[model samples]
Target: MDIPSGDTARKRISESTIHRLSRYFRTLSLLEKENFETVSSKELAKREKLTPAQVRKDLSFFGSFGTRGLGYPVAELKAKVSRILGIDRIWRVALVGVGNIGSAMVSYKEFIKQGFHIVKLFDNDQRKIGSNHKGIIVSDIKNLRTELQDDRIEMVIVAVPATVAQYIVDDIVKAEVKAILNFAPINLKVPSGVHVRNENMVMELEYLSFAMVNHHSPKGGGKA
Candidate 1:
């Protein structure tokens, strides 16, 4: 297959392929920790429970990184995948609503490990406003847009109730914050240029329930 290079490949990348890239990065990290110098497509596919062709196809979307006998350099490939996923640099983020899920997101160590720093926090509750967690003082939701702009937040996590999610997102849009991770059950209406991803735990659980009841095997069952 012709391995396309340059920015053109980015425009044609699929969300599933991006997700697989994350999985590849994770496996590569594990392999590096295990002192594996290089990994072949078959080995990567075996670890990820995928086919070698699938693995090669995913990497081919970006560019050729593997050699016939040498395979792929673990650390170098991991770094390349990180850059591809745009997680190589730190992203300034703000979390709106200091409720249950919001607080959990703040405590997640993986966020910082993945270069997503929550430098600012916001909540409408007077009790939470001005409270400190992990060295960040929670700002009042009233000042969300202004604070977000001032702090130069690249992304936001909205954990407020569904009723107010749209309202909060409207201001985030105004602040020119392009990316959002929403926990509210309701789907948010965003402008064409804005990007929003929903984290609905209940929906995921529903999918699990469906799969269990249906004995659903995922589409690809082949391993390497």
Candidate 2:
């Protein structure tokens, strides 16, 4: 099947470009909310620690998001970026493993503020499976397929332990979920067309600690 122009652009664009686009969108949204009318590529780049040429090139992937002289209109660019990122669509997400992190996410205002809604929470623990948290009742893992079918869940958040990460992911795939945000420290393999994003919190913390140590090193040579 032929991919749509938007999808093609997304596929062709580098991952770094997509990340920069997300940053630009967030910055532009803040500027728009502050009632800023126009912003130059240079200013935006300076704010985001990116090059003007890179910013322009990234925006160009979507067919000239900015004017030649006026840069990019804040509101228009915000809307365009939102559309490009598919933020306009409300994605129904099913969260597996209603433990500490998962339960916190269920009550997190940011998820609700954004379009991603956790419609179902699943856990194998009998005590938790029937409990309610933040208005999202916990359901048994066995009902994953049925709930996914009934709710048309498009995304899955796997917050299970590393030991059961693969098994839970397999169940999620069996339920036909296409996208997953995995919090476990395991590398999960999925079939083609399935997207998996790993959230390695320990790695992130280690990186942060490494950066801090290097930043405050006496000789400024603790590079890695």
Candidate 3:
């Protein structure tokens, strides 16, 4: 099967579709581990809390899978989704800031397994410089530009405080890192052609609280 081509075709495939593909990939992996050879869309959808039609529509964007009467081969579907998501090749990642979130990201083992390799850790704190965490040496943030140029780092993770997150992101942009995952609570401004995904746990928690309140509200989850 072929990946969706052309900017127009790519644009038609929504980010939510891509996210669901990852979930499907994970489900296929678990099914594989359980010795399942094939999976029907209905069965897979049940497992993922999605409707069968929704699962089928998402898979249609990539290509047809599963036989008319049979179903998808677990291993084959996983490989296809992985390739479609561009995770087939390993990605070099650089992380700036060694605060709690940053340190935990460095120690996360799943990233490497998923093909994201954190090659260097950078922090401005003097005490943290040269310190080792999770087999990665922490270097001073001043060396970021040089380190990025010397290495093939394509993605940067910024986990510093909100006050300094934009400055760190500017450095990352200057270094030509195309993608960034920022955990800082504030939004960052970047130039065109660069992508930034903000991961704010506080925002998520607040949203969760809103949902919980809505669920118990008088109108059966009506808007507040």
Angstrom error of the Cα, residue 189, model 3: value is 1.0
Which of the predicted structures, 2 or 3, would earn the higher TM-score when compared with the native? 3
Writing each residue's lDDT as its tens digit, candidate 1 over 1-224 gives 34456844344677778889999998998999999999999999999988899899999877898888889999999999999899989999999988999999999999988899999999998888889998889999999899999999999999999999999999999999999999999989999999999998898788788888989886764211
lDDT measured at residue 160 in model 1 versus the true structure, 0 to 100: 94
> Each prediction's TM-score against the native?
0.93, 0.89, 0.90
lDDT per residue for candidate 2 within 1-224, as digits (tens), equals 33467545243767778788778888997898888998889989888877798889888877777778788889998889889888877999989998888888888887766688888999999999789887778899988888887889999999989999998888788888899999999889999999999888799779778878878553323321
lDDT of 1: 0.91
Instruction: State the displacement of the C-alpha of residue 179, model 3, in Å, after optimal TM-score superposition.
Output: 0.7
Residue-level lDDT tens digits of model 3 in 132-217: 98888998899898798788789999989999988888888888889999999887899999999888888867877887887745
| CA lDDT, every model vs. true structure | 0.91, 0.84, 0.87
Candidate 2 off by > 4 Å: 1-11, 212-224
- 1 versus 2: better TM-score goes to: 1
Q: What CA root-mean-square deviation does each model show from the true structure?
A: 3.1, 3.8, 3.9
